[model samples]
Target: MDDEYAKLIRRMNPPRVVIDNDASADATVIQVDSVNKPGILLEVVQVLTDMNLTVRKAYISSDGGWFMDVFNVVDQNGNKIRDKEVIDYIQTRLENGANYAPSLQETVDALPTEEHTSIELTGTDRPGLLSEVCAVLAALQCNVVNAEIWTHNTRAAAVVYVTDDSTGYAITDPNRLSTIRELLCNVLKRNNDVRMPKTTVSSPGVTNRGRRLHQIMLADRDYERVERSGMGRVDDKSSRPHVSMVNIERDYTVITMRSKDRPKLLFDIVCTLTDMGYVVFHGMVSSGRTEAHQEFYIRHIDGRPIRSDAERDRLIQCLEAAIERRASEGLELELCTEDRVGLLSDITRVFRENSLCIRRAEISTIGGKAK
Candidate 1:
């Protein structure tokens, strides 16, 4: 009997989540048992938010690659979520996992054309410090526009230009700005090995420009997979930075880059090239099973190909750094394709299968096309 019971338990999925309602208490209790991994806390919290569920309290513990977490949650209506279907849906998603992929058209429709916000900081620096800052910004739905970081005398100062991705404008709201400031100040203080922040900061307003992208993929679409060819690849797979260049016999220069996809990735690369005096005549962007491939055909603004080896080397270094920064920042991705039934679910499943995590999403339809 013991052997049979052990076998049965072993055959079950590793992650087992249970949801229960406390009617008198006016809240739902969620218990999760799962394998431990980095960022699991963030993932669970994000799921609750996506469901419009508010967390009243949470207790988390992890040891020996296993974790047990319990969350006291309430629905948007400030009552327990007791619907069986809704509870089952949440359980399925948390147990299996789901992703929200925002289409490209959605980004164009939502982001501002010119206005953007800025964050400035000065403090002692250490390794992995920028990554931490970017992580916080990503969590807060802020996207970087321009970042300049410098260090001197063991003190680091950074000025980051950003835009609320949802609004594409400078964060002018006082409460939101205060929250960002407090969060960043706390991060910097911690990095400097200082005391914790004591003040309770205000919460900010978030305007919804479009639909939330975290709806779980169900039905046939969830089973579909994105073709590997749809995403491009580098011919020289062993390339360290996964970026290569070729001069087209004084006609044009071809720069091929392969990296994990992120929001505004193409924008960043093209912006860098344009700033460097190159004019793109044509380009192609595609997703691979695990990476994104981008090809840009261009020449100098003066219609001349990059001729000098030194200039070519400099360009290579710049592109490499840009790719590295995006990867570390953990940004979003844009998907554009002809719409069909279950399209969103299919696309999001592709990203999930490839190990891409979606932090935020927006979906919109324009001109009879879904973005």
Candidate 2:
């Protein structure tokens, strides 16, 4: 009854969305006003990220039963949004109350799926692991549909969408899935790994794939500092996000973060905090050419400020890991080739043979083409 009442209230007060190109000379300004609700902030951010726009700055305020956010966003090239169709699309999408959850799949670096099985894997990071994993899938007759992989702190995690090569549909045979999981787990395991490798198979959903990766790594505790630094080990402190927290009056924890700016950065930070059971009452975000600065006034879901140094340290570590998980470390590469069985396997094999390390990668299929 409470949930239905909230929905009714939201419907009664339609959101007011403004896409103003004149508000900021440097970037387009988007403002949304609506009845406050849980997860609405993330939904809005997800919409912009789905369109591939860079949110350079944002102001979030959801208090006193109302929600309002202002965003300064730019195109991929860091210019104001000038396309009329795009502007109209943004306004319509936000104002009409279309579901933003579906957009999350695209933001997570996967195209809308027709039918595919999501393969999740995590283990110690290694050079040839990807090649071995791909080879295992190809051997099992699973065709790569779309996927995203991230490696950090000497730990690797991947969400791969695969279909039956022969049927071009989700691999649903229980035996095949079990075999796929077993083989992939074997490929992920290392002799020196402290933790066991894991593999899970499921039909993909609207949940953001990138956030799913973050959750997987967090569960694997990738934030723990790797004492012995080597290849793919995130010992490079330079790339880690700088986080600071201070208790303010009225019992609020003010968390400030500064880091190199990237796409969907705000969303990543907010998503992590929320998942950690922290609620942001207010936030201010600003990003320059290369660096982003964010300040969030928050409290625990239990209505308390962060209590101890240990808790603070853990929070900082988790936030840093979330940021670094998606950091673009390797040379920017784009692969646009014909989609076929074993194509990904062959490509990964060449990279592994060349001793190339893949920090992060995304695979997609569109109109019979793969990228």
Candidate 3:
């Protein structure tokens, strides 16, 4: 019974806990019932609290047939907590001579039904990996409803349930699902010993991007225009997109975009380059009513172009599509370049600070010295 209670606690990641123990002849009950000893129930409460759970109340009933213990735990802020509520119930059963703990599914079902999408991720743990995953999910507009993470003996596992407030886009479309999977795979591949299996589950009633055209159309118009300019010609055959690739022997690259395009759009564009096999060594974005531009100096990871002209062109098309989808109402995007000294130096500073190094450089200027 004592071992069962321990197992139950391990499964529930509660925010707070309060327990009442009913005195029984069982060793487990006796240990908990011995409240007079320090480091017993109080110790358990401390451990739970350290895990960010709060126990507000407890009750013990040793009467015949009514022999049970009850606890009232809430979130840190005193909200009613439910994740560990079942633990107290399980303790009651153990006190009544139940020898086995509940099944994993049964225990999971005992909790409240809040709206959330559960994702199971297993991989090698590294610094900043979790943050990167969360950032991608946040960028996709997924709200984290709950998260459970465990790492033991160098193995890491995470279970996250995400939900949106509108509840309209729960989970739909294979392309978006594939994109997420690909992103996770790429991130894991960067670390040794980290491998993720390809399996995803989407909750019903979620609308995927293919069905959310209206939301996509909210991007800035100027960004859409520049993005269109970046697309490849129809004749291109590469599976990726076509964009200018300059090997930076130096440390960075400077890209100029229209003032109407937001910094966020510029960042997305650079990330798109990465998705297309281009590794950004350094970059920066500046935007104003009169000027909006991003400068990136990057290098090919394998010391060669990752995408052919045709493939690069396709990526450019996708960038245009994404910009058009994210374009804000009434903003005009127009990009033009002016000459400046040490332009490369300034751009490299941004990249260096971000831990990117350039292996080549490409510079283009209009109405200014070409040198």
Candidate 4:
């Protein structure tokens, strides 16, 4: 039986060692002897399974005996064991013994939230720049999710991930957004306008003085009338109020201004005119500023030309207020073509006299005869 056991152990390679000397007369002696040959106690389990021997109730002794899969055998009580049952036993033991790996679901569920928003800011890079930005965000109650920042020499860019609070305090308001942009511009200007100290030395006979100067151009008027004169014709009868069409017998006016002044001017002028009870039928501002200028072409709902001096004065005042507001904000303001009489001729004359180049021009009027 000892020789048979030796042959069996040589064939089977179990992960652990086990020996069964059931009710043998020399059981203790045989167990002691079996422990002497470690190689015989460590054969492959696959070979044992292929051999068809009932490896019943195998267990490793504390003294380094041969290994066994308990489910590959029948117990002394005649109960059959399954491979799955053995696997479950092994898994539970490993988990309890601190050698088990986490499942995929467990890993993923432990990750952070996926939703986020990004804010990008770029300007002159300086020490404490990031700290200042973070301070502002904290004041606004924004929770930073993730961020990546990089700076090279003197330039920097940052992508900030943020989450807005329920009170909407985390996100910047429209006015605050504009203010932030202006603040960034100011910061850049500070870096760009740094002045260097000047040095001077005495010469044997000649003296030199370092001179610095700055100049800015100022126009005599904030606004200039663009004459759209001699382009088309207008009839006298068609110029009357309630007339459906203003006969294009002569010329008409189309007003324009600097591009930056377009919006505030348009809104203020439209509001003022509407408040003064002048019905504006159709109006459109040419696509923003082209060639450093923008045009607001408007037509009165009434076909009659603006006749009274009082009405004209009121219109001029509205235009002036719009221009002045924009100018006070450091914007350039100008008026082009607001007169209907000989407008085309006057515009041509002004452009010629000033030597101003005309890149592109458009003309339209309400109740004017079709070209």
Give TM per candidate: 0.33, 0.94, 0.29, 0.21
Q: How do the residues 173-197 of candidate 3 rate in per-residue lDDT, one tens digit apiece? A: 5676677667766665533332333
For candidate 1, give the lDDT. 0.54
C-alpha lDDT of residue 134 in model 1: 65
Candidate 2's TM-score reads 0.94
Model 4 residue 49 CA deviation (Å) reads 46
lDDT of 3 at 144: 51
Taken over the whole model, the C-alpha lDDT of each candidate is: 0.54, 0.84, 0.38, 0.33
Model 4 lDDT per residue over 1-371, tens place = 99889657744632332333343332210111222232222222212222222332222221224222221233223233334444343333222221222332221111122343345544434445555555555555554443444332233444444545444223445565455445534443433423211111111111000000000000111122223232222323331111012312322223433333222233334343443434332223222222123232233434444555665554564454333332222222244433232333344346545544332122222233110
The most accurate candidate by lDDT is: 2
Better of 2 and 3 by TM-score: 2
Question: How far off is model 4, as Cα RMSD?
Answer: 40.5
lDDT of 2 by residue, 129-240 (tens): 8888899999999888888899888889998999998888998889978888888887887788889999999888767777788889999999898774568344556767
Backbone N/Cα/C clashes per model = 4, 0, 42, 28
**Worst lDDT window (10 residues) for model 3?**
214-223
RMSD after CA superposition, every candidate: 24.3, 2.3, 25.5, 40.5
What TM-score does candidate 3 reach? 0.29
